[model samples]
Target: MLDGTLDGRAWRLNDRYRHHAASEVLRRAVGDPDLGRVALVSSFGAESVVLLHMVSVVAPGLPVLFIDTQMLFAETLDYQRAVTARLGLTDVRVIRAGADRIAARDPDGSLHRVDPDACCDLRKTVPLEQALAGFDAWITGRKRFQGGQRATLDFFEPEPPTRLRVNPLAHWRPQDVQDYMIENNLPRHPLIAKGYPSIGCAPCTSAVAPGEDPRAGRWRGRDKTECGIHFIGGRMSRRKVTA
Candidate 1:
């Protein structure tokens, strides 16, 4: 279980590594006793390969928790497998919502149509929360360039009651992501060529038009911006940690 000290530790880590490069942040984090047990939470989406590749290089055997909502695109599932094999990631854990929970909450799979937030909680957030219970911190692929609540993301953040969140690529830009993938010869998500810059569950995600936000396709025509995995209540838990 986590205590109040976790927040202080996160703040200190942020201050220590604020000016470090993304690779340095990750290298120090992988085995640093301060972080305890750390895991990488990946969506294996459009830009996931960059961080995934980084992890492969830095710590190939690190625990990688992947939430398979059971509603993802076929291409996403295939890409997950291909990427794992190509990167030689030995400890990729596939997380999913319990069958009983799905039966109780979304029997007909229409929950996304009527209540996307609840659906996201059932499929993504809850499963990830449960999976992350054993770790002191988890790493994410979120970048400040994504805008919205993530625009002010830091390298390390306190995740409320317990746990710390790490965003090694918090300062990376869209071009940085693209350039990294191209320079490293990483495999791109197949759906990207089809106008799906940002991929999520098939039912809620659509294709973005030119000059539109990359995430515009997600929950199109709906007021939902996030899947409830990152936010607490329509906002990130970004309370400043003071000395």
Candidate 2:
């Protein structure tokens, strides 16, 4: 359902602000009329504080959508509270699936054990899609350094059917994230110290050893990399609609 208009706008935004600093990209995104109602979608995971802090400085009142899968670690929940307070983010909306939906789809909470993708869809994708219905665009913390389909990520992307996805940190390196967090004295996800570089749902996440990919701990033994949120129709969408 993606039309040429959204594609062209994404390309133009990328060309205009691709080389700007992460903070600049974010600041402009908040004020850009073309972007309409923009909200930051954060997991409050490892390296998430960098963007959260940036937004706090530029637009503390901007809506922040945090999807709580209800399967996250206790530490993640606590950290979410702590960080939200520390940043003084006025509009951090906590999103989640309805209780009835969970009872019908995953009553025993064993869906992740049998089907991680289905679990993610039930707990994450569906809830987030519903929560984002009111917004024209959303900001993500994805970086090109994460690799896979994100290796060539740009500053702006069109999310089919309706929505523009903004990645202010697309060009940032790992060192940049580290330096920003350290320089800003931001608190990291508590699980990071326990060897969880990429934190997702508690059931599918594990500890990664040295020399492994930072995200290797996620869905450790599966063929899956991304949670279904970033995917379209069970496949990774790599379309780069540039001019």
| Best candidate (score: lDDT) | 1
**Each model's TM-score, in the order given?**
0.94, 0.94
Query: Candidate 1's residue-wise lDDT over 1-243, tens digit each?
Result: 434486788878888899899989998998877788999999999999999999999999999999999999999999999999999999999999999999999999999999898898888887888888788889999989999989999999878777788999999988899889999999999999999999999999999999999999999999888887787445432232221
lDDT of 1: 0.90
Which segments of candidate 2 are over 4 A away from where they belong? 1-4, 232-243
How many clashes (backbone atoms < 3 Å, residues ≥3 apart in a chain or on different chains) does model 2 have?
0
lDDT of 2 by residue, 112-211 (tens): 9998878887788778888888888999999999998889888898887668999999999899999999899999898999999999889899999999
List of clashing residue pairs for candidate 1? none
lDDT of 2 at 186: 95
Worst 10 residues of 1 by lDDT: 234-243
